[model samples]
Target: MATNDYTAILNELKGEITNMVVSSASAYADAAKHDAQALLSDMDANLQTWTQQLATGEISAQDLAFLVKTQKDLMKMQALKQAGLSAIAVDKLKNDVINVITSTIIGKI
Candidate 1:
């Protein structure tokens, strides 16, 4: 079996995640800007720890999936809170975000 150099994978994943978050934030409304910025800041704080864990073999794809899910949930909730979106509308938007993130991350690996 060919051993994958997960350090490189993790690094690429991190960059992709950062890009996704930044682009999403850029599209936020003025009222939701603070929440989006906060989300990015939080992600930045954890990026180093996450990359280190993955590089050291302390985490796996499943862990990354969970992280991505949680991040998506938090981001959508924050946006909803700011936007006062209807439940149905929030669900639709959340699903879209989740799908995009999942596909982007998985496609990279």
Candidate 2:
């Protein structure tokens, strides 16, 4: 093949790869946001249930113990969810997408 043909093919492949990487990054961001929101909703529901139980005086000593344990579990889950949404991996993926986009633009220039 000619040199120009080879270069064109390479350019096309690079553009395709860049689009795919950007789309994947967007998908990751969307999924992470959804997971974080779901966790928050779960926490809110748990709080409501706990509040109602307390208001009803249905919380005996054993119930209080269980509620404390549940609270700790929810706190741990919230921390994990937050970490997952803002983790190093997500940051790296974001950087990679940005780098790919920049490279593609510069390459075209």
Q: Candidate 2: deviation at residue 13, Å?
A: 1.3
Query: lDDT of all the models against the reference?
Result: 0.67, 0.72
Tens digits of per-residue lDDT for model 2 on 1-109? 5678658757876777677667766876787778769877876887688777887897665786687688778778777876776676567666775676577556665
TM-score of 2: 0.57
> After TM-score superposition, what is the CA distance of residue 5 in candidate 2 from its true location, in Å?
3.8
Which 10 consecutive positions of candidate 1 have the poorest summed lDDT? 1-10
Task: Give the runs in model 2 whose Cα sits over 4 Å from its true position.
Answer: 61-109
Clashes by residue pair, model 1: none
Candidate 1 residue-wise lDDT, 80-103, digit = tens: 676664354456556666776677
Q: Which segments of candidate 1 are over 4 A away from where they belong?
A: 1-31, 85-109
